[model samples]
Target: MPSLNVSFSDEEMEGVRAAAAAEGKSLKQYLHDLGVREMHRKRFVAGATAWADKLRGEFDEAFPEEIPPAQRGDGAAAA
Candidate 1:
């Protein structure tokens, strides 16, 4: 397994320690979990973006005659 070493001021360390204790985790475990959660969040966002792009393409194909909401003169919201 690889390791990461980070530096923090005393005040920052104290705050981190308090947070870890509040979560019933050691500082290292808290930080590790944070990293894992961030990775999962990023993957979720990427997947969602790809899905939206595909949906947009399909919507355009299905409604070629319609003007997109953004281009409407009245700036009406899409139904």
Candidate 2:
């Protein structure tokens, strides 16, 4: 795999080093984990947004208020 060169301030580098040391990981491994986590989070949000849009379209196509907020579990505790 190809590597990209990035520059950061001395303070930033120190912070990364300290964090990696605390976690018992090399700086490279720490950065790799961070990047992977962010990518995973973005992919999850994209999937959820697509599903929500599809559901909204279906809800509109059916009845506007046929599915009430309470029935949809809108923040209320389930019975």
Candidate 3:
């Protein structure tokens, strides 16, 4: 694995150390988990957006009038 060098102010470093200790993780492990979780969160959002767009397009093509009155269950068009 590649190594990364990051700089932090003393206060910042102390805060990070405290946070890691609170979570029962070393600073390295805490940062690693944080990075991995952020990456997964971004990927999930992108995928969900794409899936929602596809579904919206399909739905618009199928129901241009916004769900059609017959399927509304109001029984006004049940004849």
Candidate 4:
């Protein structure tokens, strides 16, 4: 695994240490877990977005005459 070198002021370091200790983790483990969680969140959002687009396409195909709310001129859908 690649290593990262981070620099923090004394106060910042103390705060980070306290947080890690509160979580019962070493500083390195706490930071690593944060990175992993962020990665998973991005993946989940990407998958959800792709699924929504696919579902929308199917809906449009099934209802060819239906105008999307945004295109209605009667103010039924707020911009």
Candidate 5:
């Protein structure tokens, strides 16, 4: 329902047209799909980052003062 106007250099326009033809799409359809995929990618990254941060916080709370395995002196010290 909405429209966007974009300009490209001659070389860039040719490259875009070539890519659309290679994918069996018109330039409009190719650009539209590219935009949709980029939107989804950004949302996925944001959600994944939030989930990782929450898990990290919980882990830190559960393991305050926990020594990493590499820093632990030896198997005997671990026991």
Candidate 6:
């Protein structure tokens, strides 16, 4: 893989070193894993949000709540 020069503060470097030590990895490997995890996390959240907006209404019918029987069919209410 191509490499890039990145800078970190002393505190950040120490924390990364500690994490790498705990995981028995070099600092580069530890950061690589962390970066990959964050990338995947971002992708998952984006996909989840889109799916939620689309399918969220369907769940209400499958599991109706606080509504009378007459109201459950078409989301209208009994007078």
Best by TM-score: 6
Model 4 Cα lDDT, one tens digit per residue, 1-79: 8989999999999999999999999999998997899999999999998998879988899999988777878666554
Clash pairs, candidate 2, are none
lDDT by residue for model 1 (4-61), tens: 9999999999999999999999999999998999999999999998998879978888
Give the lDDT of residue 8 in candidate 3: 98
- Provide TM-scores for the models: 0.68, 0.63, 0.67, 0.61, 0.68, 0.69
The alpha-carbon RMSD values of the candidates against the true structure, listed in the order shown, are: 4.7, 6.2, 9.7, 5.1, 8.5, 8.9
Ranking by TM-score: 6, 5, 1, 3, 2, 4
Ten residues in a row with the worst lDDT in model 3?
A: 70-79
lDDT of 3 by residue, 14-71 (tens): 9999999999999999988889999999999999989987798788888787864557
Q: What RMSD does model 1 have?
A: 4.7
Give me the displacement of residue 45 in model 5, in angstroms: 0.6
lDDT of each: 0.92, 0.85, 0.88, 0.91, 0.90, 0.83
Please give the lDDT score at residue 79 for candidate 4: 41
In candidate 1, stretches whose alpha carbon ends up further than 4 angstroms from where it belongs are 58-79
| Clashes, model 1 | 0
Among all candidates shown, the one with the greatest lDDT: 1
TM-score of 5: 0.68
User: Which digits, one per residue and each the tens of the lDDT, describe model 6 over residues 13-75?
Assistant: 898899999999998888889889999999999999899779867877777665654657765
Which sections of candidate 3 miss by over 4 Å? Answer: 58-79
Please estimate how well model 1 matches the true structure, expressed as its whole-model Cα lDDT: 0.92
lDDT of 5 by residue, 1-79 (tens): 9989999999999999999999999999999999999999999999998997779778878988976565688955665
List of clashing residue pairs for candidate 5: none
Candidate 3 yields a Cα-based lDDT of 0.88
